[model samples]
Target: MVEFGSPVPEVVEALAAGFVSRELLDWGGVALRLTGVRAVDQPEFGSGRVRWRTATPVVMKGSGRDESGALGPRQAWLLPTEPEWPAYMQGNLRRKAETLGLDPGVELEAVNWIGPKRSFSVGNGLKPGAPVEVELSGPPETLRALWSWGLGQANSGGFGWVSA
Candidate 1:
């Protein structure tokens, strides 16, 4: 099931289409359902940070270089404490927004990893599925765009789907 702070017809329609087709290109599988959407209280952060929680597990990859200055062959998962987490999420959100012809300058103040972490198998490796709450302060339009599109890598594969 999926939920959002407000109704998003466009996102719902897109999800419905993907569900009916049982294909989402590279996202894999079509076992997702939109049970319903309801209104929720908007969180207020005194520090201009808004909390967000992932409905599905968010998966991210961090790349680095080897000792020889060549690109590393491995991609590592990003924990919330890592400085690269916010940048990674912001980049993905920006890309999605730009693809939909929306503004891509949304600001993600911070990302905090809430506990009760879990993991699931994707192909050969286990992907982490810990619930995350983030601090996002941006324009209403940009916030809406992020809400509709989702927050991190492999959104089509049901990662980083969030509610307010």
Candidate 2:
């Protein structure tokens, strides 16, 4: 029962992919199945608090039932698609630690995505509005790649990455 708490199409897609679960509370939808959840804490809006750590990425799955009471094939979206991308889990701290010649392999307990506030427009000046502030935590390079991947995926409506 991963709580997505977001409705962004890509995020929703990720949720649908079993990466996260969109808590469509306002939509009057609830998952009666009641399962487990892998929660990743994100900021309210536009907070640069990144929390990337080397851990198992959450997996998603289909859970029929939506806020509108729509029942069909659906899934929870998990993040960090592959288990090989370790940098996204450990942000600057790990990188900096490694750069400084320190043991980056050391574990850091607090790491999650950093959400942003004041979302202007999505793709091609399309406004999807803004939900809550989300915190995305990952190494600079990995985070950038994620943004690029997400945008590309969103723009193409197929598959790709988005970055800043």
Candidate 3:
């Protein structure tokens, strides 16, 4: 369950050889023992079209506007149906790309509703965790990163885990 680049061969090697054993996984302070490691990455796309399935909920955090058109007091959960969802999600992706040293031009093409929005409880507040289909256009490397790392915010919280 590690989102790492291919250039990190030393980590790959260590994990493959079982030289890396128990380590602290930051997700909820869970500790996992490494039995094996597998490499999975989306291949370079030629058509600039890639499909993704959100295996976990994609967290889109955003603020709300008050009835008088002023910004809300606190940030709240944003759903796929919201008008600004795309831009908000895109910003998250771009930041991730920058962090990963990849191009930040990745664009979210479209999202298929598939079904109604899903709600997943995280800690106390309810978060959107609906499983949906998405299409994106970007550099192959960036797309591969989105595939490997998932999408939207709070990825470390186990949301937005997608599969190509």
Candidate 4:
């Protein structure tokens, strides 16, 4: 079972079925906030399911020299495989911004349907759908948002990553 987070289907269906929010009895009494939904599938792994809820998944697809003058992956997203995945999604500020529709205007040049987390950062001409940007070092709000997004989209057959 996904420890720190709950299943995306349960959360989305609960909310869609007239439950705006629900408390995860398993996770030390933490609450989840959901926004929207999407459909996803992974045919290669023979693991096709519908991902229901969604987080405004964000990815950056450009490369430029920052003030630090360092080179890094041009395209990036809040991936599920990252060690910081849970913390990034479960922050307070991120949730607040998500609820407020504060999309940061960044876009992912490339995206993968069902592949390794690193595979999510490939391609070009991608765009974000009302995504919000929260700092990696944000507050509790940021983690909260990531949590909501992750669990809400985790096993969603109709959300997040899809396989075509």
Most lDDT-accurate candidate: 3
User: Could you give candidate 4's per-residue lDDT for residues 1-164 as a string of tens digits?
Assistant: 12122224465555445533432333337554445334332122122112222333333223333437576656333444344444443442244446645432222222223233222322353332222322233233333333344422222321232112
Report the number of the highest-TM-score candidate. Answer: 3
lDDT of 3 by residue, 1-164 (tens): 55443324464566555534544344457665555556654577767678888877777877676445678778767778776678888888788889888888888888975446778777887887466688889888777766766777776677787753
After superposition, the stretches of candidate 1 with alpha carbons farther than 4 Å from their true spots are: 1-11, 14-49, 65-71
Residue 20, model 2: Cα distance from true site in angstroms: 40
Clashing pairs in 1: none
Error of 1 at 56 (Å): 2.5
How high is the lDDT of residue 164 in model 4?
23
TM-score of every model?
Answer: 0.64, 0.23, 0.73, 0.23
Model 1: how far residue 147 lies from native, Å: 0.9
Off by over 4 Å in 3: 1-36, 66-68, 114-116
lDDT leaderboard ranking: 3, 1, 4, 2
In order, candidate lDDTs are 0.62, 0.33, 0.70, 0.33
Q: State which candidate, 3 or 4, has the greater TM-score.
A: 3
lDDT of 4 at 85: 40
Model 2, stretches more than 4 Å misplaced? 1-62, 67-133, 151-153, 158-164
Worst 10 residues of 2 by lDDT: 53-62
